[model samples]
Structure formats: C-alpha cells, structure tokens
Target: MAQSQPAQKYGPDLSVKLICPECQIPNPNVVEEFSSGDLVCGDCGLVLGDKVVDTRSEWRTFANDEGDDPSRVGAASNPLLDGVDEFETMISSRDGNSGISKELQRAAAKSSHGRSERSLMNAFRDISSMADQISLPRSIADIAKQLYKRVDEERLLRGKSTDAIIAACIFIACRQAGVPRTFKEVWGLTRVPKKVIGQCFKVLERAFGSNSPSMTPGVDTPTLNNVQSGPEDLMARYCNHLSLPVWLQSGAVDVAIAAREHGVLAGRSPITVAATCIYFSSALFGYPKSASEIGNIAGVGDSTIKSAYKILFNEKQPVLASIHDKRANVRNLPDP
Candidate 1:
C-alpha cells in the first residue's frame, strides 16, 4: 500500500500583493492572512504584511489559530473589543422589539449628540453622588426619585418652577423617610423659601393623598416627624431653667402624669405612660425621637421634656409618687 500524502492548503480568494520591507520582493495575500502586525515572506522570510488595513472587513484566520484565545490575529484586536461584537449582535437582535429598539435608538442618538448626553449623564451622576453623600436609604432614594418625577410632571402639566418642584420632591421624600426634616431642610436642599415649602407641602400632600387615600396622617406617622428641622430650633426654644439635667427629669415625670391624666380624662384605666409622654414631648420640643429612649429611660434631656422641671419635680411631687407606687405596685409609696 502507498503512504498517504498530507492535505493541501489553499490560499485566499482575493489575496493582495505586498512588497517585503526586508527582501523588497512582492509578498501576496498579506490582507488574507489571519495573522496581523509584521508578517514574513514565505520564501525569503522578509516582513511583507500591510499594517494599515480595514480590520473589520479584511481579516482572515488560519486553521491552527481558531480557539477561545481571542488574542489570535483578526479575532479581536483588544480584550475590550472581544465581547463588543457579541453585544452589538444581541442589541441588533432585540432592535425590532419596540421598547428595546426605542431605548437603543435613544441611547445611540444620545451618543451621537455628544454635549447633551455628557451633560445629562453628569446630572445623573451628581444625583447619585448626592444620594450617596447623604447616606440615604433605598426607600428614601426611591422616594427622592419619585419626588423628582412628580416635580418634572407637575412643572410640565401645571406650570411650576423647577426649583419649587425639586424642593417639593425633597420635602416629600424626607417626610416619607420619617426624617422629621422641616421646611428649613427643604430650604437648605433647594434654596427655596419656607413659604414655598409650605405651599408645595400642601400641594404635594393633596396630590399624594389623592393618589393614595389609604395613607392618612397619625401620631405614628406624624407630618412633623417627616420634616427635617435641626436641633438648633428646639434648643433655641428651650425655656425650662433647671439646667438640661433637671429639665429632663421633670419632663419625664410630667409626661407620665400628662398621659395618665389624658387616659383618666378619656375614662380609661391609667397605665404606664412610658412611650406616650416621651413621644408627645419629643414632638413638642421638636427633638422628635423613638419611643424606647426618652420616656421609660432616664437621662438629661429626658427629664424636663414633659413639663418645666419645677412643676413636676417640686410642686407636684406627691401626685407623681402616688402614680409611681401605683405603677410598680409598691406596698409603700415614697416622697417625690
């Protein structure tokens, strides 16, 4: 039997000739070879490849070169370009889908119009940066986005200023986040007037309430708690004289008494006013806080929060002792 011969290799159909830089001899099919960069002549081993070519169109591959290593000549020049072709293909396949096509077209148009796209992208980045800087929760950030959308819609639909609308959105977001930020917070965020915030608050409240009627306001979801007023405002309003310490003590006692009194007035059995008094006084003082910290617990700001320290601790001592003993079921009540 005769020995089998090796399979013959064929050249490209539209091969071009290239002059070797080394040998000055003509080298053909430089554009057809899958290899790129400097190429050597098959005969004299001289560099002959055309470095400048329309890479996307005039490229080829050898049998040995086909593998997952995209580094192969003409496979993709750079790692960055490796997945780009596939991505473009995927995008093209989805192009006929109305929504996807519209979005892609919009993005393409945006890219084509460089200035507006860059500016718009920068604005989005700024919004994201602002959200991160403030350390807003996802719920709060979503609320902010909703606020922005609402403001934009309101401006277009009802003819409001952009500033007013943005302020309204931020105000609504803070409130929804239970941040207790005031009109001042809105003013600080948007540089709008307090009255502007107030006006927008009314409008936004009506809009939100109309859209979601189930969201009625209550103590737990108090409108004040949503606003962000700084501690300075409440601190400025502090009139109680027994220092911060005595005031907190008196406040706690007074809050307890007030709750019990209110329960009595309502003809209910007087129970522990631990949460209620702290909550109520927290609001009145504008220091608005959670239930567990101020009332049941003892601290400086806690005491005078309920009333002026003098009234609860000095004048009405006996009444408090009685209530205290009753609360703990003590056999003997002590002096206040």
Candidate 2:
C-alpha cells in the first residue's frame, strides 16, 4: 500500500460525483481508494483525488469484542488474588448453538474467574456491603479486604466457617481501624452467631498475631491490634445514636472512660458499660435516657443496663469527679 504524497490541491469530498471534470461524463463512476487516500475514476482510470482522509479506524484489537476498546486489553486484574492470567472463551448466544458450545461457555466463565479469585471477589463484596449496611467507613472495607487476602494467602482455617471468618474479618477491620463496633452489633449486621464469630476471631487472631505482624513477611497488611475495643470506644457512637445533647454526649464518654479506669463495671461487656454510662449521663444532666432505649440501641436488655447502672452508681464520685466540665453538677446526680 503506497502512502499518499502531498498533493498541491485537495479535492472537495468528491464533488465530481455529479460529473467528470476532463471527460465531460455526467454522474461519473468514481471509486474511493481508501488505502492510498485517493479517489479514482472507476471507468476512465483517472486520479480523481489524492490526500483524501480515509475516515476509517486506524486501530484494532484482539480483545473480546468489548465496545469502544481499540487496544488489546481486558478488565484490570485484582492484586488481592494470587491468580491472574485467567482465560476466557466466547460462546455464541444465537439459538441452535450446540450443547458443546454451552459447555464451553460454562467452562470459560468458571476459568475466567479462578476459584480463589472468585472467592476473594465474593468475600470483598460481602465485606463492603456489610460495612455499608452498618454505616461503616470505606477505609474499613479496604482494610477488611486486605485482611481477608492475608487469611486466604495463609490458607488459614481451611474448609471452615467461611462466613464466620468473613464476618470476623470485618469485625477485626472495625477494631483495627479504631472505629470499633461491638460483637453484638457485628452479629446484628451479619447474623453470624456471636460464638461462631468469636471462634473465627480466635483463628484470625492467631493467624495474624494480635500483638505483632501477620503470618506472612513483607506483606503490607499490618498486624491485628487488640480485638476487644474498650467501653469508652463505644460511648461516642452510642451517645450519638441516643441523640443526647453535646454536653451530655461528652459527659457520657467521660463517665464511661472513668468507669473503665475505676473498674466500676468490671466483668461487664463493653456494650453494657457504655449503656450504663449513657443512662447515668442522661440522669445526671436531667436528660433522662430510659434503660430500655439505651438497651435497644446497645444490644443489651433493660435489666442489664439497669444492673450495670446500679453498679456504676456506687462509683458516682469517682466517675463524675473525672468530668472536668462543671456543667455536669454532681449534686444533681441521683443515687441508684
């Protein structure tokens, strides 16, 4: 194919389609030679035009007939998966296609997403979806993916409760990211039994050493921290959910932290301690949060909240004394 040379004159888009210039022929049979950017006289063999733009695409691809892709490429590979190079085969969708073709389609679809990749994809999606449902941050989703990837790489808990493991991954992601959620809250979101989730958590804890780095070396995924978040950590979220006033929210957090420091609610779940602090804070500030309300949000019973508050009541001076804000009048705090 010869390239078109720079012609002195460029013809208008074959205006001579109506008639021939030199031959005086009407409605000339002109042919477009797109390869060399020329239009020639189909009958008289004249160079009717040169330097004509081809107007055809110059790029092509070997990729599956995906729309608008001019280069040989496929979807971006996930770094989280161990396998990449997964192959695919296209099967005709037209009716009367042989059963062999359908079989080939199924095989290709399965191979295109390798078993490990498929599992990781599903787990990642579940983690993200669960996080969104619980109103957790995007960072939690990313971290959870990383943690799950590590677990997969190590082959931890082979053939075990994968859902519980995934739920535990999310549970750990929340605590490790510092915006912790209680196990009950995680249970509420995942519906995984708390005992099963806890068992899976232990497996993950050993897999990714709680006080140190993960099992694999040179991996960028950080080691898991203390999985159990403190009572004070729960107060901020619980207070916000209760819609307590700003002063009362702060006062509640202060009381919770003080309770933890003073061992006021020892052997109690962080959720219970947090609910107690909220109920106590409301009472002190005259904002009155019934045990039922706090219990419902905190995933504890009213009796549990009242019981914990009863214990927390005995240490009112130590807890309220920790409040630097003078607005929380100790004189107004009721004795339980």
Q: For model 1, how does the per-residue alpha-carbon lDDT over 244-294 read when each residue is reduced to its tens digit? A: 334443454554555445432133212213333334434433344543354
Candidate 1: how many backbone clashes? 20
**TM-score of every prediction relative to native:** 0.35, 0.67
TM value for model 2:
0.67
Off by over 4 Å in 1: 1-135, 154-163, 177-179, 212-336
Q: How displaced is residue 336 in candidate 2, in Å?
A: 3.5
Candidate No. with top lDDT: 2
Which residue pairs show backbone clashes in model 2?
none
How many residue pairs clash (N, CA or C atoms closer than 3 angstroms) in each of the candidate models, in the order given?
20, 0
Error of 2 at 108 (Å): 5.6
* lDDT (Cα, tens digit) per residue for candidate 2, span 196-238: 8888889888766644333235754445654558777887788
- Scored by lDDT, model 1 comes in at 0.44
